[model samples]
Target: MAATAVLQPYNEAQYDHRAFDSLMDVDESAYYFDSLTGYEHLRSGLRDIFMRHGVSDELAVALLHRHFEMSTNEKLVELGPVSSPWPIAAHEDSVLGGHILPHTWRVFENELHPLEFRFIPQQEFQDARKVQFSQAFFEDFRQYVKANGLENVVGITQLDHGRDADESDVQLMEVTHGRNSIMVPAVPSSDVSGPAFQTIWSFVEKQSSKLDADGIQTRHGLCYKASSTDAANDGIQTRHGLCYKATSTDASNDGIQTRHGLCYKASSTDAANDGIQTRHGLCYKADSTDATTDGIQTRHGLCYKANSNDGIQTNHGLCYKATSTNTTNDGIQTRHGLCYKANSNPTTA
Candidate 1:
């Protein structure tokens, strides 16, 4: 007699099909696992089967999701065919840095298996998106993977989009090797209103200290000026009429006179002199003395001497050494102070 063949009914419960229902039905899925032994057995078997077929573990897991309607509920089991093959057509490649796409079944060229289909879960898709280029964080991630012996595995960085999405809805950043693409969240970093820039600035500031003692060479850093007065004044004041007093006893001068990366001096007595000075390499008066002597004296560079008390005094004067009546011999010399023409000698003046 010929051996009788028996066919068994597909037992959805055997491999935990209920888990798939939960995963498909819910917006998010939690991990499920059978007993420890079952988990090990399924994983080993699936890996062996895939290895024999020359499929990668990643691709194999994807195939399970695609063709078998199978998902890990802590262990692998047959869930039967829940859906038809959803092959991803080629030419849909749109990989960019800092972006994410929905996960789905796709066909890719495998080294051993020419054409292979894999189901990339939303999580795996998210993991792939987190890769950043040429960043310290990326280097750190590389070190971590190397240390953990997970060089082939991807790392994730969760981005918090408060109020816009649920607390659980975190965008991820992935770090992986051999990929020249970056996967970021769907939302642009510009759209997300958070302390990301501030955090970056803070990091830059920290790193800047090591590179230069002056710190970041930007004018955006904080600047604190000792008030002309010791009184607590924490309100905005007008830029003008708050000049630096030439005399040390000028008690009216009371507040910060200059902003960051600037300096102040009580030099300009011109009508434009507001008592405050800027290190903009502009000319200003050093004293109320006659135009012949008090000519424009810059806080940093050469001073121009006035020839007369008349308005022409502002025009007829040779540039002199700062704080001195001595004539500057250089022609067209540019310094961090006032701009003026130098006289060859006092006789020429």
Candidate 2:
């Protein structure tokens, strides 16, 4: 009798959204087989079918794994040529195998339609990675979301690279509640790849917010990025998510416009409008001159009580005055005391 391999029956949850580069040491136990002979026969059949059909060996193992997990029969019974659930592209070295299945697929009234597949060349994939992204990335992603017309991305799950990479740097990401995943790059980067997944999720969020019932950008300014620095120069800036930018200016004033919005001049008589100056060049705006509110609490605490008329008005509507004495604020105290903190409201030019 031939030695029978004790198969560790395929567990559906254990193999979700997995990616495998090579098939050299795939655990035979993870797959279901009646006998050692059955396993060998199945591998032979799969190898023959895949080789004849121009399927990569890596993808062959992946397809079988998927079939095993999804089928109710749960037996290694099929020896026929199997169509891949997803579009297949041949990798020169290893198959892009392992649970590369779609989370959901649509059927019409319980009738299965012929699925279409496309095989993109690996060189084209490499070429795509070189494209410079800024606004164009958002535009293309916006179109993708619009075409899919799917719901917002509710969650992001990282996938295992399956012995190909260390645990700290798995880059594959699955976007939940969306039509398909936002695949992370295969390259390992503990610092960049981890945050890249979050970036993708955030991009989805902004696009979804801008998308209306018709999946159009009819609701403007939701995910808006200033094409020119005109909006930033004018003190109208949106800081949330992808739209965040550092406040830079040529304006010589006590206050600076920032991503928070516009910083304006406050009335000195109203104690509520005056407080310690913050590093962003805004007054903390206290209701009363208490110990916490009156003292130099912040690093940019160049705040002082002075006449509103003594203040010089900024282009951004903020008030500033030249200080007589030096102070310990982050900026040079040659200019001192901002009257109001920046607000989310945009001022008209």
The lDDT values for all models are 0.23, 0.22
Please give the clash total of every predicted structure, in order: 20, 1
Error of 2 at 73 (Å): 27
The candidate that wins on TM-score is 2
Residue 290 alpha-carbon offset, candidate 1, angstroms: 31
Model 1, span 1-349: residue lDDT tens: 1232342322111222232222210000001112122223223433333233322212212211111232232222111111122222232322232222222211111101111112234444554422112233233333433443322211121122111335323332211111111222223221211111000000012121112221111111111111112212333221111233334332336532332222343343233555433332333433443333444433111122322221110111111111112344322111112233333221111
lDDT of 2: 0.22
Off by over 4 Å in 1: 1-130, 133-251, 254-263, 267-349
Where does the lowest 10-residue lDDT sum fall in candidate 1?
Answer: 194-203
Candidate 2 regions exceeding 4 Å error are 1-99, 102-151, 156-158, 161-248, 251-254, 257-349
Quick one: best lDDT, which candidate?
A: 1
